[model samples]
Target: METREHYFNRINRFGRISFTIFFVLIFTIPTIVCAAYDIFPGLATVLKATLGLFLILTPIAVSEIVSFVPLLGSGASYLTFETGNVSNIKLPCAMNALKLAGVQPASEEGEVLSTISVAVSSIVTTAVIILAALLLAPLAPVFADPAVKTATANVLPALFGALMVSFLAGGDAGSVVIKGQWKAIILPALVVAVVHYLVFPIKGWEGVTILVLLPVTILGARFLYKKGQITVTPKVAKD
Candidate 1:
């Protein structure tokens, strides 16, 4: 049997190793691949565009996702890496990116207000863009052929596959390799996949799949927490 000290040491080591691998796989690999692709010729231009877009759109996405499931809002925020005081609203990176992109800043007071205003405007802009896309979807024939539409639909699955590969490449791969975490990952994944494809087809309720699965995920997480199976501690100070 494992001693308590041995368990603690293993947990700490695994935590560090897991997060280090996670960061390398998620961020570093993506950066390296993008660089290799030469998708954007100029690094400076790409950086500016990426920062500006992330800053302007992330908050909006956070808000929308939170609105769907208020209980998971904190999780969503954590996933998106949002920082700074939301009330005071400082977006330094975004501001700098905008400036680099030749967008003039407003006055000092305007800078503070601009952040809030832009975040709010982002929601409206996203909605308009979605609506415009939906309206124009019927004109797909005029813009692109059936082959292009099929390719566009496949992008989501491609991204999902990449994410799965990344997760497995860096996550508790040792445990999973030994089949310890396979049940955990497979159960949830199968539930989600089945609900998305099969249940939605039969029931015609896309949102119901999320509603059914999220609670199951939460319950599974609680079970894991109780059994000392999963531990996710925040980097912030705890009271």
Candidate 2:
């Protein structure tokens, strides 16, 4: 008897409440800790310490919500942000689930599957963080080694590289996956190469690598779209 509308309504109602509680907790915890330690400092000092982060993270947060919410739907967005890791774990996990399930993000099945994937990602991330905390003392000496430090420094790069490779390898030529135009691949590759060789060394553009790449991608895609090379075909349901 429950229609998809009713299902989404229920999920949205609960998800809003959950997000509200989490928002309150995040802000409250900072105040609570400051009060307990009597370390409020001055308003200026606090702002000085936090201003850069506030400016940088605010836009990134807004952009991420815009980028991710459509794919995650109502429930999973709340859960994934609360769990705190988005790019590394939550997104890839949800993406893989969608790939396996063969559903478009707007579909009912995609919504449910995305919710489940994010929930599981949250649970696993919590468990891993807890276990790592518990094991930290025992692992300290090993982690203190020079070689270990070097490897730790490279971990993020390696992880991202692997993710990129997986994504590129995922597209079959017949399927024409993910924008599916020569412009999408060749143009971006040239842009990335040029940026790395020429633009990346500029001090002003440092740390906003994604910001640069994103506009280039959109422009490239739009150009292809105008040329009619990029078509809007509905996804075929997998058997």
lDDT of 2 by residue, 168-212 (tens): 443322233444444465676787678778866533343355455
TM-score against native, each model: 0.34, 0.74
Deviating ranges (above 4 Å) for candidate 1: 1-67, 71-142, 162-185, 192-203, 233-239
Q: Give the candidate number with the greatest TM-score.
A: 2
Candidate 2 residue runs with Cα over 4 Å from true position: 145-183, 201-239
Q: Global lDDT for candidate 2?
A: 0.74
Overall lDDT per candidate, in order of appearance: 0.47, 0.74
The alpha-carbon deviation from the true structure for residue 100 of candidate 2, after best TM-score superposition, in angstroms, is 2.0
